[model samples]
Target: MTYPITRSYVAIAAPPLRSIPLHFSAACLTGALLTDIAYWRTAEMMWTNFSAWLLTFGLLLGALAAIAVLIDIFSGRLLLRGGLGWLYIIGNIAAFVVSLFNAFIHSRDAWASVVPTGLTLSIVAAVLIVINACLGWAIIRQRTGGLEE
Candidate 1:
């Protein structure tokens, strides 16, 4: 005898994922990659090099991530209700601010450019964003009890 297939519709009670953390995580990683390019440009002392292109691309991605987060918030899929949410927001904001400073002001120098400062800021931002992602992942894991929710 063969067993019959069974299907059931189940409602998930766990809170919807807060996608902002993932977006910010991506932004930070992209920013860090751009910073690496910037540092390389500083070493080469060339402004109109591949670094500029990479920076522009990174900026675009960062903007997209921000827009995605905003849309998710408005659509009620993402929430900024808890401590982790706030931390994620703060980290993302700080990363954005520092990235702006590095890109606009400090990146202009020809010789040294903003390598040191921008690299430091990018690393810090990436760390914070990754930590925030980990926190969210931990929560989801705990809620799901080691299974996909």
Candidate 2:
């Protein structure tokens, strides 16, 4: 009699819940950039307010995401491959810092807020967020072998 060969595989997956805050933070940061553009085009105070609130929410959610990442690292659920993880972390921190400064600039009078500095900061932050998101997703995909659970 011939016996059939069997194989077992171990799956590497990240906690789905950990990514939720990151997604939201990205959305909020992108929204802030849009609102900043709107305010620049129309000089509307409401848009300025919207930008401020979006930045605030984005930063808060980013903090939550950072905490989750830290937990994963400490718990050995996440492994840094070729320092991509550190680059992602640094990019995120830079984005948050830029957004924080933009939030403060938004607190100024409406026109002065979105004219040049605020709008520039929003653009920079949005770009940084995008880059970091790409890096993060790449890391995740590499770890999961392109399968996310």
Quick one: best lDDT, which candidate? 2
Off by over 4 Å in 1: 1-7, 10-42, 46-48, 142-146
List residue ranges in candidate 2 displaced over 4 A. Answer: 1-17, 145-149
RMSD of each: 4.9, 2.4
Distance (Å) between predicted and true CA of 11, model 1?
A: 5.7
lDDT of each: 0.57, 0.86
- Top-scoring candidate (TM-score): 2
Local error of candidate 2 at residue 66 (angstroms)? 1.5
Q: 20-135 in candidate 2: lDDT tens per residue?
A: 89889989988999998998888878999999899899989988988987887787666776889889878888998998898898889879888899999999998998898799
Lowest summed lDDT across 10 adjacent residues in model 1 is found at 45-54
